[model samples]
Target: MLVQDAKNLVIERGGVLNCLGPKLGARFDYDADLRPLFPLIKGNLANAQLYDRPERVQFLLDGILCTIYAQEVVAAPFLERDQVLRFIHRLTATLNDLYTRRHSLGRNHRKTTMLPVYDIYRLLPGTNCTACGQPSCLAFAAALSRGRSYPDRCPGFRQPIAHHAVYPVYDQNGNLVSTLEMELAADADELNRQAQPTREHPAVALLTAREEEVLRLLAKGASNPEIAVALAISPHTVKTHVGHLFDKLGVNDRTQAAVWAHTHHYL
Candidate 1:
């Protein structure tokens, strides 16, 4: 029933819904047909299809795997089949509500307004420091898509001479929508200051004192194997802790986390 509902919903939204063969590896292709409706929608449903598998739902719920893709919810590698169905039911309801509201507003709410980083890189310090908690230049670009952060928090982009620039609009399906005027620097700065630090761990506030010590050791050049020996835990256990640390830190790489720890005096 869940699968059928999902298929129907996808079609109702004008999305192409095809069941992938096993050899395709749980892949689906939500093409440009749904572009205008969900501007953030990107290419191929490769990651989104992972939710169809029963064993990966826990990862989805924990945000360990894909969370939301193309506006569809996905799970990770250990979710049960029944759980996936339930998720679909909940998702469908939420989407229905959203669609109703959007209809009333006479606009597609899934469309996201974005600013390209290249046009504004000149206003940014271009340090790629991850001080804002993102790893690379492109990662920052992606974040800007959400309008959560601004170019000036970069410290380098705070120069007075930098000109403001606007990015082209896109739908959730990664389809081009329209171009918007560049955001004023004044507005951008206000938004940046209001941006909260990305939650590293959803289950806790920052790291615990013990976790901080472990992270400090990691920043100071301790390998997972070495950390395990120092903390008197098995290497596998160290790996688990490290995984948690990465999520808590919202870091994609250990080096970035290390840099953050050093810059913020976590080390």
Candidate 2:
């Protein structure tokens, strides 16, 4: 099966993709054949938001498959042709990073069933004491909901409700995804970690809005001409913006710019 082949390739390349339980979070399982031939649900979700072109998505999937196949075929120990494989791997990583970033920023994936902090606090004993460190239980609960505070900070909730509170995530069909079996606090901790604020690079602020949009496309592994076509701009304009981004970010090449942008949340 193509999915099996993809799995094998990943394993052969010293990578592991495991199906984590609901407590950990929903895992993205790719069917190797389906990945190239069919559109991913996440890609569909992104298309709905105009974050990616369908053709580009297909191309990225195809490139990923090709890279995997190349890795499987070039199983030699010698350095016969290292540069080509390294370039492919870098491109694959950039495409994957862009897909993840688009999914993360999509409004459709936002927590829809999050319980209001006030409601959770109302269930608590209405003590205005600073035991929780925010002057009131409501403040503490709000911070917890925002991922700015942990449940353990609330002295009252630590023992009683910490084990029952649940975070929400939607499956591909818009249904609630079942979390893996785990204690509630453990699940909450995992959720909180995922919700931490991303850090943006200082150089990102130097980009014009148009340049930023182009950069996002580039980070998604779009070629300069492809980006120009998507944005209805000339290829020359795309190259100009690319050059500006490289200068501002102090990078010498597209791959490095992409890596820095992804690492700093600029993409």
Candidate 3:
């Protein structure tokens, strides 16, 4: 599969740009009918929204909207785009290939229900307490929904408040002033809209197809003989493949090689 056609690398409006860094937009090319990419993508991304009928998977990468369509892929920060592309390629290798990692996306691979302020207001204690510096709980809910304030600011929520988090709210000094940062789904997006590019990941590009297969098998705790049997190859060939993977991953042992694969998102 010719996974993607990277049309052009655009440097976003405001910042120092890296070689592979604001965004890469591409018309994805693949036999879409055979692969379960939407489910796989919805499974891998941490923040994702999926539409079942239209077949769209939307997610946020470093605060950028990574909208994936049946025929296209758009993501910001060169490294992120590269990562998504590689992930797609790895998954598309076989119909059964699926990503096994931290997935935080759709609730049911369905459309996102609009969450209005009224719905949030109903969840509040309705105490009308000024303990959070707000005039009332409704006002606090409003602010909380916008992510302008956090739930911990309210003394009423000493216990958990269903789905809300008491994340750290950093001050201008980059010091933790309070653990009162609440993310109400949509409002928890990154504070900085102008995303900065991440460091390059050149390790993935160094591995060959056979090495990748060997790495995947190693990640599954397979031995050389197991891998040989799985790939329909001899144990000696499997050893050679494993050696090449180790050299590329800069790891001496199979365990280290597996760790490298996982850390690099290759597995």
Query: Model 1: residues >4 Å from true position, as ranges?
Result: 1-66, 69-92, 99-162, 165-185, 188-192, 195-214, 247-249, 260-267
| Tens-digit lDDT track of model 1 for 128-153 | 88776566554555455335456544
Instruction: Write the residue-wise lDDT of candidate 2 on 61-135 in tens digits.
Output: 222222112122212111223433454455445445545554454333222122345445544456767565454
Clashes of 2: 4
lDDT of 3 by residue, 197-245 (tens): 2112333544545667778889879999999899888898888777756
Ranking by TM-score: 1, 3, 2
- Candidate number achieving the greatest TM-score relative to the actual structure: 1
Deviation from truth (RMSD, Å), model 3: 19.8
Q: TM-score per candidate, in order?
A: 0.38, 0.27, 0.31
How much lDDT does each candidate structure score?
0.44, 0.43, 0.50
User: Where does candidate 1 have its weakest 10-residue lDDT segment?
Assistant: 11-20
Evaluated at residue 188, the lDDT of candidate 2 is 61
Ranking by lDDT: 3, 1, 2
